[model samples]
Target: MDLDTGVALSRHDDHVDPFPVRRAEPAHAVPAGRMGYDLGAERLLLHTVQSAEAFESLLTTGTLRPDPELAEEAFTDAYEWIHRMMAARLPTRGEGALWFWARTRRKHLVDTCRRSRGRVLLTCRVPRERVLLSHFDEWHLVLNKGLGMPRLPGESEDDAFARWEEEHDDFDARLRAAGMRDAPVRDWPADLRTEIEKSWESIFDRGNYGPFECWQGTTHALNNDEVLEAVRII
Candidate 1:
C-alpha cells in the first residue's frame, strides 16, 4: 500500500549511545503556513457543556481556584509527566511528528509559566482534532492533537517503528513506480516544487501533507504536555 503523503517519516538508529543529553530550548515560534480549522456547532456545544461541568464541579466543592502560581506548577508538572509517559510508548503510528513538536514546544511553555508568575489563561480545543486537551500560553497555544490511527494493545516501540518503516518503504516503492523518484532530494518537476516554494500555504496544499490541525492560542498558557500530546496523536 502506498504511504499517505501526510505520513512521511525518517528513521533513527536504536543502537545509538544512551543518555544523549542536550541543552533545553524553548519553543520559539508558531509553525508558519499551517492551516487552522473551525469547529462545527455540535463540537462547540459539547465542549461548552464539558467546560461548564468542570467549572461546576469546582464550585460545588467550594474549591478555590489555585493562585496562578500553583496552577502553573500543577499544569507544568502534569504536562511534563504526560509527555514522558507518551514517549515511553514510542513509534506508535503518529509519534514522530506529534512528539517532535511537543518536545520543542514544552520547553517554551514551561518557561513561560515559570516566569509569568502564574498569570496565564487556559482554554481547550474542540475534539475534532482528537486532542484530549489544549491551552493558550502568552504567545502560542499547545494542543493535544491525537492521531486517527489506533494503537493495538501490547505493541512495543521497536515493533511499531519496524512496521512504520516497512510501510514507509512500501510507499516509496509506489512513488518510484509512479516515476516520482527522479529527485527525492531535489526539485524534479518544476511545477510542483515551484508551487511549494511560492508560499507556505501552497507547500501544505501541494507539497507533503501531514496529519495535524492548527491549534491556535496564546503561547504562554499552552502547557508542554498538552502540545506534545497533540503532536503524538497527529
Candidate 2:
C-alpha cells in the first residue's frame, strides 16, 4: 500500500467539473505524507515519522500508537490504569497552574489538534526551556505531499529526502499549470450547485454531497484545475 496522495480539491479551480464526466474504474491510490509541529507536555515535538502504515493507522483509528504510530482501540475504560501511571510521572497541571503561560500554550495546541481531527501529525519537539522565542513563534505545519519528508520502508535518509524534494517540485508544477488560481468562495451559485450535485452522484454514486467540506476553502495562490481530469493524486 503506497498511499493515497490524491490531489485534494481546492476552491480556486476555474472548472470544478470535467467537460464530460465519466466514471472510471477504481485504482490503487498512491501514498502521501503529512508533517507538522506539536506542543506536547513542556516540549516541542517536531513531526518526523509519517509512514504509509502509520497514516493508515490514523485513518482507521483516532489514536496514535507507539509502534505503527497509529491503531484502533476503544478507550471505553478510558485506559484508567495507564492514565494513572502517566499522571505519576507528570502530575496533572492543577487549575491554579492553568493560569501559567506554559499551560495556556498547551491548551491552545490540544484544542486545535482536537478540532483538526486526526489528520495532523506534530513531530517537531523542542523544549520551551531551551528554544528561543523567535524560533518557537515560527512554529507551523502543512499537510500536503510536498511538505514533510519521511523515510520510506527501506530507503536511506538521504534518498528519502531527495524523493521528497522531487515530489514537492512535481506538485508545484501541477499547481503552476493550474496557474495557481481558484474560484472565489461563496454560496454555491445555481450552475456550480448543479455541478456539485452531479459530483455527489457521479463521484461516489451517492445522493447527498459527501465531499462538500473537502472541496471548500478560501481561494488562494494554489495550482488547481479541473481540466486535468487524469490527475493521479496519491
Candidate 3:
C-alpha cells in the first residue's frame, strides 16, 4: 500500500509473510560474521522524515529521541498510551520511541517529505525485537478514545456498545447522554479498559486487519551509527 496515496499494491495469491527476510551487515562496531549468526531474524529496513533542526541534533548528539514538545496535546497523550503499550507488548531497548514506516514505498517517502517539509530522510536497520508494528487505520480508535471491540455477527458498533453497556451500567452511554465528551481511558471500567488493551494487541497482527497496507513501527532511540542512510530530501 502507498502510505501517501492510499493505493493498494499488488499481492500474490499466496499468504503474505509479515516479516521481511533480507539480511544485512549489522550496524557499526559489530564483529564481522557475528550478525548473520547472532541476529537470527532479519532486521527491519525503515524510513522516517525529520526537520533539518532534528537532523542536526541527531548528528550532534549521536542519537535521536522523540520530541514531545513538537507533538500536539492529543498526540502527546496518544504517544503516552503507545509507549505504555510498547513496554508491555514489546521488548523495548531504550527510553521513548521514534516512529517509522515499515516496508514502505518510495512515493510514500517522497510524499511524506513534501507534506512535512522534511529535509532529511533517515533509513535505518533495526532489530525486530525493538519494534512494534501497528495498522495505521485502526490506530484512530486509540487516538479518538473509541472502543475497539469486534462486533458480533450482524451487530453494528452501536448495537455492540448497547449490549456491552448493559453489563457495565452503561457508563459510557451515560456520559454521552450527559453531553460529556472525551472520557479518558483511565476512567473507564477496569474490565473494559482491559478489553481495550487486549484489542490494541491486534495492531501488531497485520493479518487481523486484513489487507491494510500502512503499518507503522515504533522503536527506541536510534544512534547515528545505526542509520544506514540519511538523504537530504529538500
Q: Which is the leading candidate under lDDT?
A: 3
Greater-lDDT candidate between 2 and 3: 3
Ranking by TM-score: 3, 1, 2
Report the C-alpha displacement of residue 108, candidate 1, in angstroms. 4.6
Q: Candidate 3, which ten residues in sequence have the lowest lDDT sum?
A: 21-30
Candidate 2 per-residue lDDT, tens place, 28-116, comes to 12113322233234653322213344444433453323441122233211122222222343323211100011112333433433443
Candidate 3, residue 215: how far the Cα is off, in Å: 0.5
- Cα RMSD for candidates in order: 22.6, 27.1, 12.7
Using Cα atoms with residue i matched to residue i, what is each candidate's TM-score against the true structure?
0.23, 0.20, 0.66
lDDT of 3 at 170: 59
lDDT of each model, Cα atoms only? 0.28, 0.28, 0.61
State the displacement of the C-alpha of residue 219, model 3, in Å, after optimal TM-score superposition: 1.0
